[model samples]
Target: MNPLLDERKATVEADHQWIANLEVDERARTGIPLLKVGFNETFGYYISISRAKADQVPANYIRKQTLKNEERYITPELKEREARILTARDDLHKLEYEVFVTLREEVGEQAEAIRHLSRAVAAADVLCGLAELAVYQGYCRPEMVNGRELKIVDGRHPVVEQSLPAGFFVPNSTELGNIEETSPLPDLIILTGPNASGKSCYLRQVGLIQLMAQIGSFVPAKSARLGVCDRIFTRVGAVDDLATGQSTFMVEMNETANILNHATSRSLVLLDEIGRGTATFDGLSIAWAVAEYLAMEIRSRTIFATHYHELNELAGMLPNVANYQVTVKELPDQIIFLHQVQPGGADKSYGIEAGRLAGLPTVVIQRAKQVMGQIEKHSKIAMGLREGL
Candidate 1:
């Protein structure tokens, strides 16, 4: 364009006349006119007509757009001029684009070096952020090892606790791997508690701490001795994936099966309500067997949170299985969530109590309590039979 020849300049000048001044009615000063011409990016060129004078438009006019008060048309002569102008503009643009693509390819020759530098910078940036987080959050450096012994003292959920009132987020501890003289493998925690307790948060916090430690980042713990895990599997909650044609129970079972299939002793598994998605007896049986397999066959460090209080019996039956509960303090009329994790099994799930606390209808609460009592009585008898007592 800078040094175009005489012929090219003359051709460029001729092309400009194509769209320079589209035809319009000079009678527009008085009122809306029937015939007019316009050019825009969308339709390129069109003739406008007012409904009152639409009959005066030429028969050769091709209707392109219709409006409430008027219609737009394109004539053959206008269309031919538009096509020529557009073709010339497109050719110029394509030539420029080709030049740009060639230049881009020359720069792409150095793409490999750029990508390596980018990865290094990204890693450095992540480390800088982690270091800042450690300093601000009072995180301590974790001691990482390979041979079992997963321990974390006073560990807090990094994100969950930050939003809580200061010192309100309870710091819990975790200990896995059988250190006993006669034991065969690591221990599995059977976590049980009422709804809305810190059981889920505690489970996630343990996994997060271990993951952070293994990745060479300081963890949100007073002290941590982490065992390097090959994989960290978590099945926390369920939802019906109807679009995928799977029920809530099916989704839960699939995820549970995946964990059971691939998880090794070196893996860390956090299972929340393994079989609560299905029928009571079926769910309980599956959950009970899954825990046993994890403890005996896979021997992985696992935190199993559940609403099934009956699963607590695993502590007595399996040596590698231990029980833990998120304790709640009962008030005169309301139960306060303590959010504390402590040793031993829970006496009750406190679901009805929790519903009552959540402002459930008084009549419903009373009926639930009555039904729970009947269920418990029958469950105790069934349990005795299962134990052959």
Candidate 2:
């Protein structure tokens, strides 16, 4: 569309090629195969020759620079070519900017129409992509309702399922609140299990299903009936924000506080390892209090995934709170993660087994087990004393 730009670009390229050709001819004429043509800001296009070949330079090569082991020289022809090349670049830039301004003005005339068409195209692209995903991945349309009920039968993680082979990613079901004649489920689910038993994945799955349903897209489930939520809040994983001068624990508490302050009965909250960055008892205590608050005060649909098995007591105390665990098959030497979330609270986290599977040294693993045993013994005694007191 711009002939001036094309012509200027060709001129620049041809000038550069001329310098390269000049170097090749000079190398052959002077019998210096190591001669190179280069350009720097301080010294415009110059031919570099090693000190050993200083005597071999042609008479027309005027010395421009002297390095530790090389001498740079520029011929009169090369100097003139350099000036043209440099000026042509500046002219090219100015011409390009002028052309750009002209094109931009032309585009600006139809800016409204362009924006309208762009919005339509973008919407169609998104819808087509989602429809394709639904067809290929066997996603089911969710039945959204006005009431506070979320039910999914055999739901899978949208992203994780795709990464695995077909039918490899296990699907799990979730039910909360009452729908029609169905019995009411808990508002808050206390999810506990071993270190790598898919508790976090299950929590994320529920949140994603709810989000996908609300966005008018088919969810990655065999069947689902979801209620529209005002907001979906998540506090997952621990990462210290050093730039903001906040530790991992501080970040966790800040997010938790935000969820508690703003979340309502119509909100969906997904929390994972809420207070594991602090001391064991401190973390457990905070997790317990957070779960209780979400169940009682906020009354939000929550999936609290934590290693604190003690929080399972909330299910016993709170009517709106329930307990779920990612089941595992314990073997003699190791544990197999079932990746199945079922109703019940796990008594053990099996952290040492996880560490062992992660390839910790035998001595370290044994020492960890010993320490764990002692801690459990002391915890039981402490509980007994507290109960008595």
Candidate 3:
């Protein structure tokens, strides 16, 4: 399985709450049956009555009658009797209409208030929900556990970490160095390893950390120093665009190109198996050039995972370029991945051993071994000849 795609899917899954809240807000604004009633309930009666009696002449008639009655108050008993009669007459229909109109106006104001309030409330809800989910799913800490800029201790995959049994799933921690006020943020991190290593997992962890930070949650490291980023670009999965008539390799290159053109120093980029979509030599050349551009031009925080060992040469020339490898210890015919990330380049790609784990046919495995030996011998001979020339 493609680890990069798996990580992206996991991130999306963990953020289910934020997505749900967004959907709710969209429905509410568009009048798509919100979960709770708004000002409509409070003002329904006022609006209904106003519409029903809008054409009535009772209000005008009562005003004229009251004016005429006010002019005949001369004797005390007669004045009292006249006042009572006038009050009763005014109360008949005009009072009700006045009360209804007043109530309608008040309700209209309330409805407008609710409309304005919904937007702010919805945005806050979404941001809070994202943070809460990050903590709950183990992508990041629920609260700031350390005084440091960021800290994540024993954090696991927000999604995969959930499926594991209660006591399983190891946690990893990260923090910036204390000597430097801020961590040395590299423009590029080159990750090299054989198949089935944890390079993809490490890349995913970084992406998840940034996502949590953006949503205003503590990260999964024991301590973290975070610089806010504007955009996160991931180019991990490779698939042919059948609709566009582009090959898988072309699609991959297009994504890479887009990233190069658009990503800024504040962006976070994760690239996995960058050149696997094309021919070996061509893919290596493109991958090498992309890495160089990220290091020299974009200068963004980037995590690039690939099987190409040639790219490791960047460490010598690029100041901020760091080499990391997913470690594996091998026996004669068995291999075990430590699932650990350490500084430096990997020396070998154990493809045959990985194929063995996948249970390839015995004959195929044997032939592969033979072919591999022949290729290595020929490569050595060619190198010697070139040196002589």
Candidate 1 all-Cα RMSD:
7.0
Candidate order by lDDT, highest to lowest?
A: 2, 1, 3
Q: Which of the predicted structures, 1 or 2, would earn the higher lDDT when compared with the native?
A: 2
lDDT digits (tens) for residues 1-389 of candidate 1: 32333444455467666545445332353244545667789998887878777766666778899889988888787788777777766665666677678778987999999899999999999999999999999999998876788989999999998898888888998899765557543379999888888888998999899888988899999999887899999998778898999999999999999999999988999999888877888988898889889998999999999887777888877788899999999877778889989888887888898787789999999999899889777767337635852
Whole-model lDDT per candidate: 0.83, 0.89, 0.64
Enumerate residue pairs that collide in model 3: 150-223, 150-224, 151-221, 151-222, 151-223, 151-224, 152-220, 152-221, 152-222
Candidate 2: residue 51 Cα off by (Å): 25
Please write out the lDDT profile of model 2 over residues 1-389, one tens digit for every residue. Answer: 89879999999999988987998899899999999999888888899999999999889999988999999999999999999899999999999999999999999999999999999999999889989999999999999989889899999999999899888899999988645455668999888999978988888899999998887899999999999999999999879999999999999999999999999999999999998999987887788788888888888889999888878777767788889999999889878888998999999999899888889999999999999889887776335434542
Stretches off by above 4 angstroms in model 1 are: 1-99, 180-186
Candidate 3 residue lDDT tens string, 290-312: 99898888777788898887677
17: Cα error in model 3, Å: 47
- TM-score of each model, paired residue for residue: 0.74, 0.75, 0.61
Candidate 3: 10-residue stretch with minimal lDDT = 42-51
Task: Score candidate 2 by lDDT.
Answer: 0.89
Off by over 4 Å in 2: 1-99, 178-182, 381-389
Sort by TM-score, top down from the best = 2, 1, 3
